[model samples]
Target: MLYLWIKAFHIVFIAAWFAGLFYLPRILVNLAEVPPDSVAERARLIGMAQRLLRFATVLAIPALGLGAWLWLGIGIGKGPGNGWLHAKLALVLLVIGYHHGCGVLLRKFVQGLPTHSPRWYRCFNEVSVLLFAAIVVLVVVKPF
Candidate 1:
Protein backbone atom coordinates (compact mmCIF):
# COMPACT_ATOMS: atom_id res chain seq x y z
CA MET A 1 0.00 0.00 0.00
CA LEU A 2 2.72 2.42 0.98
CA TYR A 3 4.75 1.22 -1.95
CA LEU A 4 1.87 1.84 -4.31
CA TRP A 5 1.42 5.36 -3.03
CA ILE A 6 5.10 6.06 -3.31
CA LYS A 7 5.21 4.68 -6.82
CA ALA A 8 2.19 6.76 -7.80
CA PHE A 9 3.75 9.95 -6.51
CA HIS A 10 7.01 9.02 -8.14
CA ILE A 11 5.28 8.70 -11.46
CA VAL A 12 3.43 11.96 -10.94
CA PHE A 13 6.52 13.92 -10.04
CA ILE A 14 8.55 12.37 -12.81
CA ALA A 15 5.89 13.39 -15.29
CA ALA A 16 5.95 16.90 -13.90
CA TRP A 17 9.72 17.03 -14.12
CA PHE A 18 9.57 15.82 -17.70
CA ALA A 19 7.15 18.61 -18.49
CA GLY A 20 9.86 21.08 -17.48
CA LEU A 21 12.51 19.08 -19.30
CA PHE A 22 10.46 19.20 -22.46
CA TYR A 23 9.69 22.91 -22.25
CA LEU A 24 12.97 24.31 -20.93
CA PRO A 25 14.91 23.52 -24.09
CA ARG A 26 12.17 25.06 -26.16
CA ILE A 27 12.57 28.20 -24.10
CA LEU A 28 16.24 28.06 -24.91
CA VAL A 29 15.32 27.76 -28.52
CA ASN A 30 13.30 30.96 -28.25
CA LEU A 31 16.11 32.66 -26.37
CA ALA A 32 18.62 31.69 -28.99
CA GLU A 33 16.47 33.15 -31.71
CA VAL A 34 15.55 36.38 -29.97
CA PRO A 35 16.44 39.41 -32.10
CA PRO A 36 19.63 40.98 -30.86
CA ASP A 37 18.06 44.44 -30.76
CA SER A 38 15.08 43.34 -28.73
CA VAL A 39 16.67 43.90 -25.34
CA ALA A 40 13.38 43.67 -23.49
CA GLU A 41 12.42 40.42 -25.17
CA ARG A 42 15.81 38.90 -24.47
CA ALA A 43 15.57 39.83 -20.83
CA ARG A 44 12.08 38.41 -20.60
CA LEU A 45 13.11 35.11 -22.13
CA ILE A 46 16.10 34.81 -19.83
CA GLY A 47 13.93 35.41 -16.83
CA MET A 48 11.49 32.76 -18.02
CA ALA A 49 14.30 30.27 -18.52
CA GLN A 50 15.69 30.94 -15.06
CA ARG A 51 12.35 30.47 -13.36
CA LEU A 52 11.53 27.31 -15.32
CA LEU A 53 14.88 25.75 -14.50
CA ARG A 54 14.39 26.46 -10.81
CA PHE A 55 10.88 25.05 -10.90
CA ALA A 56 12.10 21.96 -12.65
CA THR A 57 14.77 21.47 -10.03
CA VAL A 58 12.12 21.65 -7.35
CA LEU A 59 10.01 19.03 -9.15
CA ALA A 60 13.04 16.80 -9.57
CA ILE A 61 13.72 16.53 -5.85
CA PRO A 62 10.49 14.76 -4.97
CA ALA A 63 10.55 12.59 -8.06
CA LEU A 64 14.07 11.46 -7.23
CA GLY A 65 13.33 11.17 -3.53
CA LEU A 66 10.23 9.07 -4.08
CA GLY A 67 12.08 6.93 -6.58
CA ALA A 68 14.85 6.34 -4.05
CA TRP A 69 12.38 5.51 -1.33
CA LEU A 70 10.67 2.97 -3.57
CA TRP A 71 13.94 1.40 -4.61
CA LEU A 72 16.03 1.53 -1.42
CA GLY A 73 13.51 1.96 1.35
CA ILE A 74 10.64 -0.16 0.13
CA GLY A 75 12.62 -2.48 -2.14
CA ILE A 76 9.64 -2.59 -4.46
CA GLY A 77 11.57 -3.75 -7.53
CA LYS A 78 14.97 -4.83 -6.33
CA GLY A 79 15.38 -8.54 -6.82
CA PRO A 80 16.10 -11.19 -9.41
CA GLY A 81 14.67 -10.56 -12.87
CA ASN A 82 15.01 -6.89 -12.08
CA GLY A 83 17.83 -6.03 -14.45
CA TRP A 84 15.38 -3.61 -15.99
CA LEU A 85 15.62 -1.44 -12.89
CA HIS A 86 19.34 -1.10 -13.42
CA ALA A 87 18.80 -0.07 -17.01
CA LYS A 88 16.15 2.37 -15.92
CA LEU A 89 18.53 3.85 -13.36
CA ALA A 90 21.18 4.34 -16.00
CA LEU A 91 18.69 6.16 -18.19
CA VAL A 92 17.59 8.21 -15.21
CA LEU A 93 21.21 9.20 -14.75
CA LEU A 94 21.26 10.25 -18.38
CA VAL A 95 18.14 12.31 -17.77
CA ILE A 96 19.92 13.95 -14.84
CA GLY A 97 22.89 14.60 -17.06
CA TYR A 98 20.57 16.14 -19.60
CA HIS A 99 19.10 18.26 -16.82
CA HIS A 100 22.58 19.43 -15.87
CA GLY A 101 23.36 20.16 -19.48
CA CYS A 102 20.30 22.41 -19.62
CA GLY A 103 21.60 24.34 -16.60
CA VAL A 104 24.97 24.75 -18.27
CA LEU A 105 23.34 26.04 -21.42
CA LEU A 106 21.11 28.31 -19.39
CA ARG A 107 24.14 29.80 -17.69
CA LYS A 108 25.80 30.35 -21.03
CA PHE A 109 22.69 32.06 -22.33
CA VAL A 110 22.38 34.22 -19.23
CA GLN A 111 25.94 35.37 -19.82
CA GLY A 112 24.95 36.33 -23.39
CA LEU A 113 27.46 33.82 -24.67
CA PRO A 114 25.28 31.07 -26.01
CA THR A 115 27.23 28.95 -28.44
CA HIS A 116 24.54 26.77 -29.92
CA SER A 117 22.37 27.72 -32.83
CA PRO A 118 18.58 27.64 -32.60
CA ARG A 119 18.62 24.60 -34.87
CA TRP A 120 20.92 22.83 -32.48
CA TYR A 121 18.64 23.70 -29.58
CA ARG A 122 15.64 22.44 -31.52
CA CYS A 123 17.35 19.10 -32.01
CA PHE A 124 18.40 19.02 -28.37
CA ASN A 125 14.82 19.50 -27.30
CA GLU A 126 13.94 16.08 -28.71
CA VAL A 127 16.43 14.33 -26.46
CA SER A 128 14.06 14.34 -23.50
CA VAL A 129 11.36 12.73 -25.57
CA LEU A 130 13.59 9.89 -26.64
CA LEU A 131 14.85 9.36 -23.10
CA PHE A 132 11.33 9.45 -21.73
CA ALA A 133 10.12 6.91 -24.25
CA ALA A 134 12.95 4.56 -23.46
CA ILE A 135 12.36 4.95 -19.74
CA VAL A 136 8.65 4.22 -20.08
CA VAL A 137 9.45 1.07 -21.98
CA LEU A 138 11.92 -0.11 -19.38
CA VAL A 139 9.44 0.49 -16.58
CA VAL A 140 6.34 -0.90 -18.24
CA VAL A 141 7.78 -3.71 -20.25
CA LYS A 142 10.63 -4.51 -17.92
CA PRO A 143 12.14 -6.30 -20.85
CA PHE A 144 15.36 -7.99 -19.78
Candidate 2:
Protein backbone atom coordinates (compact mmCIF):
# COMPACT_ATOMS: atom_id res chain seq x y z
CA MET A 1 0.00 0.00 0.00
CA LEU A 2 2.72 2.41 0.98
CA TYR A 3 4.69 1.53 -2.11
CA LEU A 4 1.70 2.09 -4.32
CA TRP A 5 0.95 5.45 -2.76
CA ILE A 6 4.53 6.57 -3.12
CA LYS A 7 4.64 5.44 -6.70
CA ALA A 8 1.52 7.42 -7.48
CA PHE A 9 2.93 10.55 -5.96
CA HIS A 10 6.19 9.99 -7.80
CA ILE A 11 4.38 9.65 -11.08
CA VAL A 12 2.40 12.82 -10.52
CA PHE A 13 5.44 14.85 -9.61
CA ILE A 14 7.49 13.45 -12.46
CA ALA A 15 4.76 14.36 -14.89
CA ALA A 16 4.68 17.95 -13.68
CA TRP A 17 8.45 18.19 -13.72
CA PHE A 18 8.71 16.85 -17.24
CA ALA A 19 6.02 19.20 -18.48
CA GLY A 20 7.97 22.15 -17.14
CA LEU A 21 11.20 20.82 -18.54
CA PHE A 22 9.70 20.49 -21.98
CA TYR A 23 8.12 23.96 -22.03
CA LEU A 24 10.80 26.04 -20.33
CA PRO A 25 13.26 25.92 -23.19
CA ARG A 26 10.52 26.69 -25.63
CA ILE A 27 9.60 29.72 -23.53
CA LEU A 28 13.21 30.77 -23.57
CA VAL A 29 13.18 30.44 -27.31
CA ASN A 30 10.57 33.22 -27.47
CA LEU A 31 12.11 35.16 -24.63
CA ALA A 32 15.33 35.32 -26.57
CA GLU A 33 13.58 37.11 -29.36
CA VAL A 34 11.42 39.46 -27.33
CA PRO A 35 12.45 43.08 -27.63
CA PRO A 36 13.68 45.11 -24.70
CA ASP A 37 11.31 47.95 -25.49
CA SER A 38 8.43 45.90 -24.16
CA VAL A 39 9.47 46.03 -20.53
CA ALA A 40 6.15 44.96 -19.01
CA GLU A 41 5.71 42.15 -21.47
CA ARG A 42 9.28 41.03 -21.00
CA ALA A 43 8.84 41.03 -17.25
CA ARG A 44 5.71 38.96 -17.63
CA LEU A 45 7.51 36.44 -19.79
CA ILE A 46 10.42 36.21 -17.40
CA GLY A 47 8.09 35.90 -14.46
CA MET A 48 6.19 33.06 -16.03
CA ALA A 49 9.37 31.23 -16.92
CA GLN A 50 10.72 31.66 -13.40
CA ARG A 51 7.48 30.41 -11.90
CA LEU A 52 7.53 27.33 -14.11
CA LEU A 53 11.04 26.59 -12.96
CA ARG A 54 10.01 26.95 -9.36
CA PHE A 55 7.07 24.66 -9.93
CA ALA A 56 9.31 22.10 -11.59
CA THR A 57 11.67 22.08 -8.65
CA VAL A 58 8.87 21.64 -6.17
CA LEU A 59 7.59 18.66 -8.12
CA ALA A 60 10.91 17.09 -9.05
CA ILE A 61 12.53 16.99 -5.62
CA PRO A 62 9.77 14.95 -4.02
CA ALA A 63 9.40 12.71 -7.05
CA LEU A 64 13.09 11.95 -7.09
CA GLY A 65 13.04 11.31 -3.36
CA LEU A 66 10.17 8.88 -3.70
CA GLY A 67 11.91 7.24 -6.61
CA ALA A 68 15.00 6.78 -4.50
CA TRP A 69 12.90 5.14 -1.83
CA LEU A 70 11.25 2.85 -4.35
CA TRP A 71 14.64 1.86 -5.65
CA LEU A 72 16.82 1.65 -2.55
CA GLY A 73 14.18 0.85 0.04
CA ILE A 74 11.51 -1.20 -1.66
CA GLY A 75 13.28 -2.50 -4.74
CA ILE A 76 16.37 -4.68 -4.81
CA GLY A 77 19.77 -3.64 -3.49
CA LYS A 78 21.28 -3.45 -6.96
CA GLY A 79 23.79 -0.69 -7.51
CA PRO A 80 25.28 0.51 -10.82
CA GLY A 81 25.68 -3.00 -12.20
CA ASN A 82 22.44 -2.95 -14.19
CA GLY A 83 23.15 -1.02 -17.31
CA TRP A 84 19.65 0.40 -17.76
CA LEU A 85 19.31 1.52 -14.17
CA HIS A 86 22.82 2.98 -14.30
CA ALA A 87 21.99 4.99 -17.38
CA LYS A 88 18.77 6.18 -15.81
CA LEU A 89 20.57 7.30 -12.68
CA ALA A 90 23.18 9.11 -14.76
CA LEU A 91 20.48 10.96 -16.69
CA VAL A 92 18.67 11.72 -13.46
CA LEU A 93 21.83 13.21 -12.02
CA LEU A 94 22.19 15.30 -15.13
CA VAL A 95 18.64 16.57 -14.69
CA ILE A 96 19.32 17.36 -11.07
CA GLY A 97 22.41 19.29 -12.11
CA TYR A 98 20.35 21.14 -14.66
CA HIS A 99 17.82 21.94 -11.96
CA HIS A 100 20.53 23.31 -9.73
CA GLY A 101 21.84 25.42 -12.57
CA CYS A 102 18.38 26.90 -12.97
CA GLY A 103 18.27 27.64 -9.28
CA VAL A 104 21.57 29.46 -9.55
CA LEU A 105 20.21 31.52 -12.39
CA LEU A 106 17.09 32.23 -10.38
CA ARG A 107 19.15 33.56 -7.54
CA LYS A 108 21.10 35.73 -9.90
CA PHE A 109 17.93 37.05 -11.44
CA VAL A 110 16.43 37.81 -8.08
CA GLN A 111 19.54 39.67 -7.10
CA GLY A 112 19.13 41.95 -10.09
CA LEU A 113 22.24 40.65 -11.80
CA PRO A 114 21.28 41.95 -15.21
CA THR A 115 19.62 38.74 -16.32
CA HIS A 116 18.14 40.32 -19.42
CA SER A 117 20.87 38.96 -21.62
CA PRO A 118 19.11 36.44 -23.81
CA ARG A 119 22.35 34.96 -25.12
CA TRP A 120 23.41 33.24 -21.91
CA TYR A 121 19.86 32.33 -20.96
CA ARG A 122 19.25 30.86 -24.40
CA CYS A 123 22.41 28.79 -24.15
CA PHE A 124 21.38 27.51 -20.77
CA ASN A 125 17.94 26.73 -22.16
CA GLU A 126 19.44 24.65 -24.94
CA VAL A 127 21.53 22.71 -22.49
CA SER A 128 18.56 22.14 -20.18
CA VAL A 129 16.38 20.90 -23.02
CA LEU A 130 19.04 18.49 -24.27
CA LEU A 131 19.77 17.09 -20.84
CA PHE A 132 16.09 16.72 -20.02
CA ALA A 133 15.35 15.02 -23.33
CA ALA A 134 18.19 12.62 -22.74
CA ILE A 135 16.90 11.83 -19.27
CA VAL A 136 13.42 11.23 -20.62
CA VAL A 137 14.78 8.85 -23.22
CA LEU A 138 16.79 6.97 -20.64
CA VAL A 139 13.76 6.62 -18.41
CA VAL A 140 11.38 5.59 -21.18
CA VAL A 141 13.65 3.32 -23.21
CA LYS A 142 16.06 2.22 -20.51
CA PRO A 143 18.71 1.78 -23.17
CA PHE A 144 22.14 0.70 -22.12
Candidate 3:
Protein backbone atom coordinates (compact mmCIF):
# COMPACT_ATOMS: atom_id res chain seq x y z
CA MET A 1 0.00 0.00 0.00
CA LEU A 2 2.78 2.46 0.86
CA TYR A 3 4.65 1.54 -2.27
CA LEU A 4 1.55 2.08 -4.34
CA TRP A 5 0.94 5.49 -2.81
CA ILE A 6 4.51 6.61 -3.43
CA LYS A 7 4.38 5.37 -6.97
CA ALA A 8 1.12 7.21 -7.57
CA PHE A 9 2.43 10.54 -6.31
CA HIS A 10 5.65 10.04 -8.19
CA ILE A 11 3.67 9.66 -11.38
CA VAL A 12 1.74 12.80 -10.54
CA PHE A 13 4.83 14.88 -10.00
CA ILE A 14 6.49 13.55 -13.12
CA ALA A 15 3.44 14.45 -15.19
CA ALA A 16 3.33 17.96 -13.80
CA TRP A 17 7.05 18.44 -14.30
CA PHE A 18 6.77 17.20 -17.85
CA ALA A 19 3.88 19.56 -18.42
CA GLY A 20 6.14 22.48 -17.54
CA LEU A 21 8.91 21.04 -19.66
CA PHE A 22 6.55 20.74 -22.61
CA TYR A 23 5.09 24.21 -22.41
CA LEU A 24 8.07 26.46 -21.54
CA PRO A 25 9.83 25.95 -24.84
CA ARG A 26 6.66 26.70 -26.72
CA ILE A 27 6.62 30.04 -24.94
CA LEU A 28 10.22 30.53 -26.04
CA VAL A 29 9.19 29.87 -29.62
CA ASN A 30 6.79 32.76 -29.29
CA LEU A 31 9.42 34.93 -27.61
CA ALA A 32 11.74 34.36 -30.52
CA GLU A 33 9.10 35.46 -32.96
CA VAL A 34 8.19 38.62 -31.06
CA PRO A 35 9.07 41.80 -32.91
CA PRO A 36 11.86 43.82 -31.33
CA ASP A 37 9.56 46.82 -30.91
CA SER A 38 6.78 44.78 -29.26
CA VAL A 39 7.89 45.52 -25.74
CA ALA A 40 4.66 44.67 -23.93
CA GLU A 41 4.18 41.34 -25.62
CA ARG A 42 7.79 40.33 -25.07
CA ALA A 43 7.60 41.26 -21.39
CA ARG A 44 4.44 39.26 -20.93
CA LEU A 45 5.93 36.23 -22.62
CA ILE A 46 9.07 36.52 -20.50
CA GLY A 47 6.99 36.63 -17.33
CA MET A 48 5.12 33.53 -18.39
CA ALA A 49 8.38 31.76 -19.12
CA GLN A 50 9.75 32.72 -15.71
CA ARG A 51 6.79 31.34 -13.80
CA LEU A 52 6.64 28.11 -15.76
CA LEU A 53 10.33 27.44 -15.30
CA ARG A 54 10.05 27.90 -11.54
CA PHE A 55 6.94 25.74 -11.37
CA ALA A 56 8.52 22.91 -13.33
CA THR A 57 11.69 23.01 -11.26
CA VAL A 58 9.73 22.82 -8.00
CA LEU A 59 7.82 19.76 -9.24
CA ALA A 60 11.01 18.11 -10.42
CA ILE A 61 12.43 17.99 -6.88
CA PRO A 62 9.61 15.94 -5.38
CA ALA A 63 9.33 13.85 -8.49
CA LEU A 64 12.98 12.98 -8.27
CA GLY A 65 12.79 12.50 -4.50
CA LEU A 66 9.88 10.13 -4.69
CA GLY A 67 11.52 8.31 -7.55
CA ALA A 68 14.61 7.92 -5.39
CA TRP A 69 12.43 6.73 -2.55
CA LEU A 70 10.83 4.20 -4.83
CA TRP A 71 14.21 3.02 -6.02
CA LEU A 72 16.29 3.24 -2.85
CA GLY A 73 13.72 2.87 -0.10
CA ILE A 74 10.95 0.89 -1.78
CA GLY A 75 13.43 -1.00 -3.96
CA ILE A 76 11.51 -0.86 -7.22
CA GLY A 77 14.63 -1.35 -9.27
CA LYS A 78 17.43 -2.65 -7.12
CA GLY A 79 19.76 -5.67 -7.32
CA PRO A 80 21.05 -7.54 -10.37
CA GLY A 81 19.40 -8.06 -13.77
CA ASN A 82 17.98 -4.56 -13.56
CA GLY A 83 19.49 -3.18 -16.70
CA TRP A 84 16.20 -1.61 -17.66
CA LEU A 85 16.21 0.40 -14.44
CA HIS A 86 19.69 1.63 -15.23
CA ALA A 87 18.60 2.81 -18.64
CA LYS A 88 15.63 4.62 -17.14
CA LEU A 89 17.91 6.37 -14.67
CA ALA A 90 20.15 7.53 -17.49
CA LEU A 91 17.19 8.97 -19.33
CA VAL A 92 16.04 10.69 -16.16
CA LEU A 93 19.44 12.37 -15.92
CA LEU A 94 19.10 13.61 -19.46
CA VAL A 95 15.66 15.04 -18.74
CA ILE A 96 16.95 16.76 -15.64
CA GLY A 97 19.75 18.34 -17.65
CA TYR A 98 17.21 19.42 -20.22
CA HIS A 99 15.12 21.00 -17.49
CA HIS A 100 18.05 23.15 -16.38
CA GLY A 101 18.82 23.96 -19.97
CA CYS A 102 15.36 25.52 -20.24
CA GLY A 103 16.23 27.82 -17.38
CA VAL A 104 19.41 28.83 -19.15
CA LEU A 105 17.49 29.61 -22.28
CA LEU A 106 14.97 31.63 -20.29
CA ARG A 107 17.81 33.67 -18.81
CA LYS A 108 19.15 34.32 -22.27
CA PHE A 109 15.73 35.54 -23.35
CA VAL A 110 15.56 37.81 -20.32
CA GLN A 111 18.81 39.36 -21.47
CA GLY A 112 17.41 39.86 -24.98
CA LEU A 113 19.95 37.43 -26.27
CA PRO A 114 18.35 34.23 -27.46
CA THR A 115 20.92 32.44 -29.58
CA HIS A 116 18.56 30.06 -31.35
CA SER A 117 15.98 30.58 -34.05
CA PRO A 118 12.27 29.93 -33.50
CA ARG A 119 12.58 26.85 -35.70
CA TRP A 120 15.40 25.63 -33.50
CA TYR A 121 13.18 26.12 -30.47
CA ARG A 122 10.41 24.14 -32.15
CA CYS A 123 12.82 21.27 -32.58
CA PHE A 124 14.05 21.68 -29.00
CA ASN A 125 10.48 21.52 -27.74
CA GLU A 126 10.09 18.02 -29.13
CA VAL A 127 13.04 16.76 -27.11
CA SER A 128 11.03 16.40 -23.95
CA VAL A 129 8.30 14.68 -25.90
CA LEU A 130 10.76 12.08 -27.07
CA LEU A 131 12.31 11.70 -23.62
CA PHE A 132 8.91 11.35 -21.99
CA ALA A 133 7.85 8.77 -24.55
CA ALA A 134 10.98 6.75 -23.89
CA ILE A 135 10.40 7.06 -20.15
CA VAL A 136 6.86 5.76 -20.45
CA VAL A 137 8.00 2.85 -22.53
CA LEU A 138 10.73 1.92 -20.08
CA VAL A 139 8.38 2.04 -17.13
CA VAL A 140 5.54 0.16 -18.76
CA VAL A 141 7.33 -2.28 -20.99
CA LYS A 142 10.55 -2.74 -18.97
CA PRO A 143 12.28 -4.27 -21.98
CA PHE A 144 16.03 -4.08 -21.59
Candidate 4:
Protein backbone atom coordinates (compact mmCIF):
# COMPACT_ATOMS: atom_id res chain seq x y z
CA MET A 1 0.00 0.00 0.00
CA LEU A 2 2.76 2.42 0.79
CA TYR A 3 4.49 1.60 -2.48
CA LEU A 4 1.26 2.20 -4.37
CA TRP A 5 0.78 5.56 -2.70
CA ILE A 6 4.30 6.63 -3.47
CA LYS A 7 3.89 5.55 -7.08
CA ALA A 8 0.68 7.51 -7.33
CA PHE A 9 2.22 10.74 -6.07
CA HIS A 10 5.28 10.17 -8.20
CA ILE A 11 3.05 10.03 -11.24
CA VAL A 12 1.23 13.14 -10.10
CA PHE A 13 4.42 15.14 -9.65
CA ILE A 14 5.79 13.95 -12.98
CA ALA A 15 2.62 15.09 -14.68
CA ALA A 16 2.80 18.48 -13.02
CA TRP A 17 6.48 18.88 -13.85
CA PHE A 18 5.81 17.99 -17.46
CA ALA A 19 3.02 20.53 -17.55
CA GLY A 20 5.54 23.23 -16.72
CA LEU A 21 8.08 21.81 -19.14
CA PHE A 22 5.50 21.90 -21.93
CA TYR A 23 4.30 25.45 -21.21
CA LEU A 24 7.49 27.23 -20.27
CA PRO A 25 9.00 27.01 -23.73
CA ARG A 26 5.75 28.15 -25.26
CA ILE A 27 6.05 31.22 -23.08
CA LEU A 28 9.54 31.73 -24.49
CA VAL A 29 8.19 31.38 -28.01
CA ASN A 30 5.71 34.12 -27.28
CA LEU A 31 8.38 36.24 -25.67
CA ALA A 32 10.59 35.90 -28.71
CA GLU A 33 7.80 37.11 -30.95
CA VAL A 34 6.98 40.13 -28.91
CA PRO A 35 7.96 43.43 -30.54
CA PRO A 36 11.22 44.86 -29.33
CA ASP A 37 9.45 48.03 -28.18
CA SER A 38 6.86 46.19 -26.10
CA VAL A 39 8.52 46.63 -22.75
CA ALA A 40 5.46 45.91 -20.69
CA GLU A 41 4.70 42.76 -22.62
CA ARG A 42 8.26 41.50 -22.32
CA ALA A 43 8.26 42.12 -18.60
CA ARG A 44 5.00 40.30 -18.18
CA LEU A 45 6.26 37.30 -20.07
CA ILE A 46 9.49 37.27 -18.08
CA GLY A 47 7.57 37.33 -14.83
CA MET A 48 5.38 34.49 -15.98
CA ALA A 49 8.35 32.43 -17.10
CA GLN A 50 10.22 33.00 -13.84
CA ARG A 51 7.27 31.92 -11.73
CA LEU A 52 6.61 28.87 -13.90
CA LEU A 53 10.25 27.82 -13.79
CA ARG A 54 10.36 28.15 -10.04
CA PHE A 55 7.18 26.15 -9.63
CA ALA A 56 8.52 23.53 -12.01
CA THR A 57 11.69 23.24 -9.96
CA VAL A 58 9.61 22.72 -6.83
CA LEU A 59 7.54 20.04 -8.53
CA ALA A 60 10.67 18.29 -9.73
CA ILE A 61 12.07 17.83 -6.24
CA PRO A 62 9.13 15.77 -4.99
CA ALA A 63 8.90 13.93 -8.26
CA LEU A 64 12.55 12.98 -8.12
CA GLY A 65 12.40 12.13 -4.44
CA LEU A 66 9.42 9.86 -4.82
CA GLY A 67 10.92 8.29 -7.90
CA ALA A 68 14.11 7.63 -5.99
CA TRP A 69 12.10 6.06 -3.20
CA LEU A 70 10.30 3.85 -5.67
CA TRP A 71 13.51 2.75 -7.27
CA LEU A 72 15.99 2.54 -4.38
CA GLY A 73 13.79 2.23 -1.31
CA ILE A 74 10.95 -0.01 -2.52
CA GLY A 75 13.05 -1.54 -5.32
CA ILE A 76 10.56 -1.28 -8.13
CA GLY A 77 13.24 -1.80 -10.76
CA LYS A 78 16.49 -2.58 -9.02
CA GLY A 79 17.37 -5.97 -10.42
CA PRO A 80 20.29 -6.78 -12.66
CA GLY A 81 18.06 -7.58 -15.68
CA ASN A 82 15.92 -4.45 -15.37
CA GLY A 83 17.58 -2.53 -18.16
CA TRP A 84 14.33 -0.82 -19.03
CA LEU A 85 14.44 1.14 -15.81
CA HIS A 86 17.89 2.35 -16.65
CA ALA A 87 16.76 3.48 -20.07
CA LYS A 88 13.78 5.23 -18.58
CA LEU A 89 16.04 6.98 -16.11
CA ALA A 90 18.33 8.13 -18.90
CA LEU A 91 15.40 9.62 -20.75
CA VAL A 92 14.23 11.25 -17.55
CA LEU A 93 17.64 12.88 -17.17
CA LEU A 94 17.38 14.23 -20.70
CA VAL A 95 14.02 15.72 -19.89
CA ILE A 96 15.50 17.30 -16.80
CA GLY A 97 18.22 18.83 -18.95
CA TYR A 98 15.58 20.13 -21.28
CA HIS A 99 13.86 21.73 -18.30
CA HIS A 100 17.04 23.53 -17.33
CA GLY A 101 17.61 24.59 -20.92
CA CYS A 102 14.28 26.35 -20.76
CA GLY A 103 15.56 28.26 -17.76
CA VAL A 104 18.64 29.32 -19.70
CA LEU A 105 16.47 30.57 -22.53
CA LEU A 106 14.27 32.35 -20.04
CA ARG A 107 17.28 34.13 -18.64
CA LYS A 108 18.39 35.14 -22.11
CA PHE A 109 14.97 36.57 -22.75
CA VAL A 110 15.09 38.48 -19.49
CA GLN A 111 18.47 39.90 -20.43
CA GLY A 112 17.13 41.11 -23.78
CA LEU A 113 19.49 38.71 -25.52
CA PRO A 114 17.13 36.11 -26.92
CA THR A 115 18.76 34.75 -30.05
CA HIS A 116 16.26 32.16 -31.22
CA SER A 117 13.35 32.81 -33.47
CA PRO A 118 9.81 31.79 -32.59
CA ARG A 119 10.06 29.02 -35.16
CA TRP A 120 13.15 27.68 -33.43
CA TYR A 121 11.39 27.78 -30.11
CA ARG A 122 8.46 25.92 -31.63
CA CYS A 123 10.80 23.13 -32.63
CA PHE A 124 12.49 23.15 -29.25
CA ASN A 125 9.14 22.83 -27.52
CA GLU A 126 8.50 19.52 -29.28
CA VAL A 127 11.58 17.95 -27.68
CA SER A 128 9.64 17.38 -24.48
CA VAL A 129 6.96 15.56 -26.46
CA LEU A 130 9.47 13.21 -28.01
CA LEU A 131 11.12 12.55 -24.67
CA PHE A 132 7.75 12.01 -23.04
CA ALA A 133 6.69 9.52 -25.68
CA ALA A 134 9.88 7.52 -25.39
CA ILE A 135 9.66 7.55 -21.61
CA VAL A 136 6.07 6.31 -21.59
CA VAL A 137 6.93 3.54 -23.98
CA LEU A 138 9.90 2.47 -21.90
CA VAL A 139 7.80 2.38 -18.74
CA VAL A 140 4.75 0.63 -20.15
CA VAL A 141 6.32 -1.71 -22.66
CA LYS A 142 9.60 -2.26 -20.89
CA PRO A 143 11.07 -3.07 -24.27
CA PHE A 144 14.75 -3.71 -23.81
**Which prediction has the highest TM-score against the true structure?**
3
Return the candidate ranking by lDDT, descending: 3, 1, 4, 2
lDDT of each: 0.94, 0.73, 0.94, 0.92
Q: Is candidate 2 or 3 superior in lDDT?
A: 3
**Model 1, runs deviating above 4 Å:** none
Q: Write the per-residue lDDT of candidate 4 for residues 30-142, one digit (tens) a residue.
A: 99899999999989999999999999999999999999999999998876768999999999899889998999999888777747989999999999989988988989998
Q: Candidate 1: lDDT of 79?
A: 70
Relative to the true structure, candidate 2 reaches a TM of: 0.73
Candidate 4 lowest-lDDT run of ten: 106-115
TM-score to true structure, per model: 0.97, 0.73, 0.97, 0.96
Error of 2 at 113 (Å): 6.6
- Model 1 per-residue lDDT at 13: 98
Residue-level error in angstroms, candidate 1, position 26: 0.1
Give the Cα error of residue 2 in candidate 1, in Å. Answer: 0.8
Q: Show the colliding residue pairs in model 2.
A: none
Better of 1 and 2 by TM-score: 1
Which candidate tops lDDT?
3
What would the per-residue lDDT of candidate 2 be over residues 5-89, giving only the tens digit for each residue?
Answer: 9888988887788788777755665665677587777687779879988888888889899989988988832755457677778
lDDT of 1: 0.94
lDDT by residue (1-144, candidate 3, tens digit) is 999999999999999999999999999999999999999999999999999999999999999999999999999877777788999999999999999999999999899774699999999999999999999999889886
Local error of candidate 1 at 39, Å?
0.8
Models, CA RMSD each? 0.8, 3.2, 0.8, 0.9
